[model samples]
Target chain A: MKILVCVKRVPDPETVIKLTPEGASIVTDNVKWVINPFDEIAIEEALRIKEKAAGTEVVLLSIGQKTAQEQLRTGLAMGADRAILVLTDQVVEPLAVARVIEKLVGTEKPELILMGKQAIDDDSNCAGQMVAELLGWPQATFASKVVLGGDQKGAQVTREVDGGLETLAIPLPAVVTADLRLNEPRYASLPGIMKARKKELKEIPLAELGVDVAPRTRIVKLETPPKRTGGRKVGSVQELVQVLHDEAKVI
Target chain B: MIEWSEQHELIRQTFRRFVEAEIKPNLRELEHGDTPPYAILRKLMATFGIDQVARARFERQIAREKEGEAGPGERAAGPEAADSAAMQLIPVIELCRYCPGMVTALGVSVGLTAAAIMSRGTLRQKERWALPLLTLETIGAWAITEPGSGSDAFGGMKSTARRDGDGGYVLNGSKTFITNGPYADTIVFICKLDEGNEPRERKVLTFVLDKDLPGLTRSRPMLKMGLHSSPTGELFLEDVRVGRERLLGETEDVPARAGAKQTFSQERAGVPAMALGIVSQCLELSVDYARTRVQFGRPIGEFQLIQLKLARMEVARMNLQNLIFRQIEMAGAGKRMTLAEASAAKLYAAQTAMDVALEAVQLFGGNGYMAEFQVEQLCRDAKVLQIYAGTDEIQVSQIARSLLRG
Candidate 1:
C-alpha cells in the first residue's frame, strides 16, 4: 500500500509577522518556516498507517518554491519514505495545486491520498476537495479518526462536523483531509534528521507538470488587525454585567 | 563567519518545540518538587536519538580499539566534528535557558563519567560500563571533588585504594557535591593509590564502581542555593573491594592528571554555551520587561539606566555567542582548546552570565525578587557557573599561569 501526503510550508505561527511597505504581502526576511500544523497531522496519519500495514510506502508531496524542500525534508525526517516536490517560485492557487496533485496521482498511483483540511497560512480549505473532485475519488474531509479495513482495501473515517462526528467508509484510492484531533505529530528525531538527507526527495519543475500554474484570485490589500484594548477589571459580577451590557451591548 | 546555518536553525526550532512540549510543563515539578531530571533527560535522549548516536559512536570507537588502533581523541575531528559540536551544544544552550541544572546533570553523566571511561578505559571496560553511560541507559557520577578538596583536588585528597593480597584493591573515599550521585547507576570513583606514601605523592587512580556495590553508600540530595533540578549528593565508600577489572584502563600508569585536565577543558569549553543560554534568556526577559514596564509616565525602556543594563546584556550575549562560534570553528579545524584557553572563555562566560542575570533582576525591580519572575531563578542558577568546572578564581589563575609559563 502507498499513502501520499500533501504538505505546505508556512511561516511559524509564533513569529511576529510584518507586512510589506505597500501591505501587499508579509515581509519574508527573518521569518522561520515550518510544515503547516494541519499538514503535520496529515503526515502523522500517513506514517501511522504505514506503521500498521506492511510494505506501505509514505510519500510526501508539496507544491511551492525550492525552499519548500525544507518542509518536505522535515516530513521525510518524520518517517515518510520519500518525497516529491513540485517546484515553482510562483504562488500556485488552490485549483492549480489540485490539478498538479491530480496529475501526480495518475503516475504515482498511491492507494490513499491524505492532506490537511486547510493550510494555516491561507486557510483556503478547498484544495483537498478540489483534488478529490478532479480525480473523481471519494474523499473524507476533516478526518478526526481513520481506521483501515481488514483487507486494507478501504478505510472508516470519522469527520469532525459542526457539533458531532460523522463516520464514512471510503473505498481504496481515496482522499482524506486531516483535522486537528487526528493525532499529535511526532518531532523528527535526530537520527531521522540525519537519515532524511539520504532519503529520496525528487523535485519536478512546475512547468513540466503541465498544469495551469496561474493564480485564480488576487489580494488587493493586506492589513494588520487592530490592536485589542486592555480589559478593565470590574468590582463585582453585577458591575461586570452592567459594563458589558452598556459598552459591548451583547449581554 | 561561523553563524548558524539554515539547517542548524531548523534543528534548533525542532528542539525548542520539544523543550516547550516536554520540559517546560514539568519544570516546576523538576525544579521545586522532588522530581529527579533523569526521566526527562532520558526522554530528551530518546526524542533526539542522542542515545542511538552515542551507541553508534561508542561501537565504532570500541571496534577501532579492539583492532589495536589508538583510541580516538575526545572527539572525532572530522568534517562533521563542528556540526557534531554544534549539535551537542545546542541542547546545552536550550536546556540552560530554563534549567541549567539539567545540563549539569546531563554533562556530568555523559560528558564526564562516560567520557572518562571512553578516553582511558580498556576495550572490555568500555563495553561493560561506558556504553550504558554514553547512552544514558545507566546514570553515571564522576566522583572527584571531596568536601575538603575543592581547590586542591589532588593534594588534599584523602580517598585511597590499597593493594589487597588477592590482586584486587580496597577503595575508601567520600565524594561530596557529586552530580547525579544520589541516583547514579555507575560511578567513576577517582582516588589515590595508597602505597603508604604522602597523599600529595600518591598516584591518582580512577575506578568504575556499580551503585549496588557493598560498603558503598549514597546520600540523599543536598539542598543548594540554586540549580535544584540537578540532584547533588555525597558518596561514601568504606573498604569497598574491587577487582582489577574495575580499574579504568586496568592500570595505575594512566596519566590521571592529564586525563582529568582534558575533561576539564571540555567542561570549561561547554560553559560558554550554557552561559549564552542564561545570559540570552536574561537579556530577552529584560528587554521585554523594559519595553512594557511603565514607570514615571513612560515605559522603563525609555530610561537611560535601564537602557544601559540592556546594552550591557546584549554585549555579553554577543561575546558569549562569538566564543561558542569560535569553539565550533576550532572543532571544525580539528583543534581542541588548551586548558588555559578554555579557562579564559569559561571565566568570561560565567562572569557575564552572573552579571547579566543580576542586571535582569535589577531591571525587574520588586517583581524580579519575587519567585514568579523567571529572572530571580535565573540569577540564582547563574551563580553556579562561576563556581563549578573550577571557580572564577581558579580560571583566572589557570589563564595567568599559561601566560607566565617560561
Candidate 2:
C-alpha cells in the first residue's frame, strides 16, 4: 500500500513560551521545537497500518517552513520510508495547506493520506476535511483506531465523537485524521536516525504546485486567555439557599 | 565528546511491546515461578544494546553538549562527574515505567561497571570492561549494604578487611539484598578495615571483587512481594581474598576516595528516583482504567467523584515527577542535598506511590485485586518502594533527626 502521512512541527505543549510583556508574538528565547503533538499520533497510526499490511510504503509529507522538515525527519526515523517537504517559510492558512497537500494527492496518488485532526497551535480541525473535499475523496476524521481493508480497497476507521464513537469505512484513496486515542509516537534511535537521513526527501515549491498560499484571515492579535477569577464563598446552606432564591435571582 | 544520543522513546516502545509479548502474557507464570526473567533481560540487552544506549545518553550526550558543539536544540550540560549520572537516569525511568525489577538489575550492573572506570580503573581496565558492560555479557552488582549498615552504610559496620601476610586483603562480611547476586560477574563490595582512626570512623573499605574470587558464595534469592522479575539475594564472603590492584582507587588514599564519604545521601538518589517512577506509572495505569472502565451504562470516568480521584492522581504524579526530576538535576550537578531533603522526597514519593497504586486498584474495582490485571500487580509492586529502598519509618527517622539538628 502506498501511503502519505502528513505531519507538522509545533512547539512542545509542555514548553513555556513567554509572550512579550505587551502580549504580541511569543517570546522565543528559550522555546524548544517539537513535532506537533497530534501529528505524532498520525505518524504512529500510519506506521502501525504499514507494519500490519505487507508491501507498505509510507511517505511523510509536511506543509510548512524548513523547521517542519525536522518533524518529517522524526516521522522518517519512526519508520516512514521517504518524506516530502512542502517548503514555505511563512504561516499558510489551513485551507492553503490543504490545497498544497491536495496538489500532491494527484502526483503521489497514494491510496491513503494520514494526518493529525488539528494542530495544537491553531486548533483548527478543518484541513483534513477540506483536503478530502478538494480531492472529492471520503474522509474519516478523528480516527482513533483503523484497520486496513483485507482486499486492499478501504479501511474501517473508529473515531471518537463528543458523546460516543462513530465508525466509518471509506473506499481506497481516502483521508484519515488521528486523535490522541491513537498509539503514542515512538522515539527515534541512533541507527533509525542515521537511516532516516538517507531516505528520499522531495521538496515541492508552492509555485510549482500551482497553489495560492496566502491566508484569507489575519491573526489581528495574539494574547493569553484571562486567568479565572476566584469564586465568592457562601457562609451556610441557609445563606446559599437565600442567594439562589433572591440575591442570585435564580428563583 | 560524551553524546547521550539514543532513541529513548524507541527503547521505551520496544520494551512495552516486549512486556506485552513476553511479560504480560506470562505474568502469571512469572509470579508463580522461581526464575526472574534473567534470560529475557539478557535478550533485551542483546537486542537493544542497553549499554550502548546508556553510553550514548549518559556518557556522550552530556559530554558533547558540555564540551563539544551544540546547536539551539541542546542545552549546556553540567560538569562531567554529574552529567552522565543525570543522563543515565532517563533509561532507568523509561525501563521502570513498565517493569522495575529487570531494570533494577540493569541499574546495579551500571553502578558496578562504571565505578571502576570513574573512580580508579586504568586505561586498560576501561578498554577491557567497557565492551562487556555495553553488551551485558557479564553481570555487575554493588555490595554496599552490610548486615549492620544499610542506610548508614559508612557510619559503622562490623565487616572487616585485614591485609594478608603477602599482599591483598582478606574480605570477611555479608551483603544482603544484593541485586543480581546469583549471576553477577563483577561486584563492588565494601569492608571495614581495622585502622588507626576512631572506631566510629573506620572510613571506606571498597574493592572490586570479581565473581570468580574464592570463598565467595551466594545464598537463596530473597522472595519479594513485587519486582518478581529481579533476583535479589544474600552474598557471603568468608575470607575472600583480592589482590592489591583490585582495591578500587589508591589504597593509601582510600579514606577520601570513598563515594559514600562524599555526602552520598545527596548524590545517590537512584533508589528514590526509581521508586518515584514506579509510583508515577501506577498513577498513570489507575487513571487510565478509571476513565475507560464503565458502570451504570456510562464511562465511570464521567462521574465527579472518579474525576476527583483521577485529578488527584495527576496532581500527585506531577508533583512527584517535579520533585524527583529536580533532585535528579541537583545530583547531576554534584550538589549535596541535606539528609532531610533526600528523605522527604523518598518518603513522600514512596508513600504517594503506594497510595496511588491502591487507588488504582480501588478504581479498578474487583479486577484491581485480580492477578490478570496489572493494577493488583501495581499494588504489590507499590509496597516494595516503601519497604526495601528505605523503610517508611526509617525515612521518617532520618527526616526527624535532620529536622531536630537544624
Candidate 3:
C-alpha cells in the first residue's frame, strides 16, 4: 500500500514575523521555515501505517517554490520513501493546490492520502476537503487516531470535535486530515538526514502540470494584533469584582 | 564567509526544539535535585541517532585497522568533516545555553575518555571499551587531575602503576574534581609507571579500568558553587589489580603525553562553542530585560550605559561565533589547531562568557541576584568555563611561552 502525505513549508511558529511596508505580505528575509506542525503529525501517521504494513511506501507531496524541497527533505528524513514537489513561484490558493493534488492522485494512485487539517500560515482548513471533493473520495478531517483494517482496504479515524471525538470508518483511497493530537512527530535521525539526500525527490514545474494556479481570495490588508496591556492588581475580591464589572464589562 | 548553511540552521532549530521540550522543563530537577544527567544524555543520543553514527564511524575505523591500515587519525578531514564539526558543536552551544555542566560531563565521557582509548587502544581494547563510551552505554571519566595536581598534573605525580611481576599491575591513585567520577562505568586512569625510578622521571601510562573492581572507590557527588547539573566527585584506587590487557594499546611504549596533549587541545577548542552558547543566551536575555525593564519613566534600554553593555555582549558573541566557525573550517581543511592557538581561543572565550554573563546579571538589577531569574544561574555557570579545560593562568602562560619561543 502506498500513502501520500501532503506537507507545507510554513514559517517557524517561533519566528518573529514582520510585515512588508504595504501590508500585502510578510517580510520573508531570515525567516526560518519548518514543516507545518499538523502536517508533521500527518507524516508521522503515514509512517506509522507504513511500519505496520509490509511493502508500504510513504510518499511526501508539497506544492511551493523549489525551496520547499527543504520541507520535503525533512519529511523524507522522517522515514518517507520518496517525495514529489510541485514547484511554483506563484502564490497558489487552496483550490489551486487541491487541483494539483487531484492531478497527482490520478497518476500516482496511492491508496490513502494524508494532509494537515490546516496550514498554520493561512489556517484555511479546507484544502483536504477540497481535494477529497475533487477526487470524489472519502475523507476524515481532524483525525486524532487512525487504525487501518487488516485487509488494508479501509481505516477507522477518530476525529477531535468541538466537545469530544467522533470516529468514522473511511474506505480505501480515502483522504484523511490530521489534527494536533494525532501523534507526536519524531525527530529526524542523523542517518535519516544523511539518507534523505539520496532519496528520490522528483520535482515537476507547476506550469507543466497545467493546473490553474490562481488566487481566488485576496488578503486586503494585514494588521498586527493589538498589544495586550498589563493587568492591574486589585486589593480585594470586591475591587476585582468592581473592575471586572465596570472596566472589563464581562461580569 | 563561514555562516551557517540552510541545513545547519534547520538542524539547530530541530535540536533547539528537543532541548526546549525535553531539557528545559527538567532544568530545575537536574540543577538542584539529585537527578543525574545520564538518562537525558542517553535520550539525546538515541533521539538524534548519535550513538548509531558513532558506532558506524567506529566500525569503519576498526575495519580499516583490522585490514592492517593505520587508523587515519580519528576524524578524517573532508567534505563531511565540516558538517561533522558543526554537528558536534551545535549541541555543545545549545546545551550550554541552559546547562553548561551537562556539556562538561558529556565532553569528559565521549570526547576525552573515549577518545583516549580510540586514539591509542589496541583493536581488542577499542572493541571492548571505547565502543560503549562512544555510544554512551557506559559513562566514562578520564582521570588525570589529582588533589595535588591542578596545572602541574604530571609534574606533581602521585598516582602510580606498579608492575606486579606477573604481567599485570597494581594501580593506586586518587583523582579530584573528576567529572562523572561518582557514576562512571568506565575510567581511563592516567598514572606514572613506577619501575623503582625517581617520581620526576617516571613514565606516564594510561590504563582502562571498570567501575566495580576491588579497591576502587568512587566518592559521592560533591557540592559546587555552580554547574551542579554535572556531578563531580573523587575517585580513590588502592591496589586495584588489572591485567596487561587493561593497558591501553596493550603496550607501554606509546607516548601517552602527546595523546593527553591532543586531548587538551580538543577540550580547549570546545570551550569557545560553550562560551558562545552562554554569551548568546545572556545577551538575548539581557536585551529582553533591558527593553521591558523600566527605571525612570523609560525603558532601561534607552540609557546609554545599558546600550554599552549590550553592544559589548554582541561583540563578544560575534567573536566567539567566528572562532567556532574557524574551528569548523579548519576541520574541513584537515588542519588541527596548535595547542597554543586552542589555548588562546579558550582564554578569550572563557573571559568573554564570564564578562557577558556578569553584565547580563547587572542589567537585570536586583532581580539578577535572585535565583528566580536565568541570569543569576548563567552567571554562576560561566565561571567554570575558565577554570576547567585549563585555568586562565595556564592558558596565558601557554600562549606567552609559544610567542617567546617563536
Instruction: Give the clash count for each candidate.
Output: 0, 8, 0
Better of 1 and 3 by TM-score: 3
What is the iRMSD in Å for candidate 2?
Answer: 6.1
> How well is each residue in B1-406 modelled by candidate 1, as lDDT tens digits?
3578755665777788888788878878887848999999999998888998999988887777778888757456765888788888888888888889999999999999999998889888988998999889999999999988987788888899999978799999899999999999999999999998777888999999999999999999999999989999999999999999999999889999888888888889889999999998899889989988999999999999999999999999989999988888888888888889999999999999999999999999999998777888889999999999999999999999999995
1 or 3, greater by DockQ? 1
The residue pairs that clash in candidate 3, if any, are none
Listed in order, each prediction's TM-score against the native is 0.91, 0.60, 0.92
DockQ by candidate, in order: 0.58, 0.04, 0.55
The local lDDT score (0 to 100) that residue A54 gets in candidate 3 is 89
Indicate whether candidate 2 or candidate 3 has the larger TM-score. Answer: 3
Best by DockQ: 1
TM-score of chain A of 1: 0.93
List, residue by residue over A64-135, the lDDT tens digit for candidate 2: 777676677777877899999987777788899889888888788999999899998779989999999999
Ranking by lDDT: 3, 1, 2
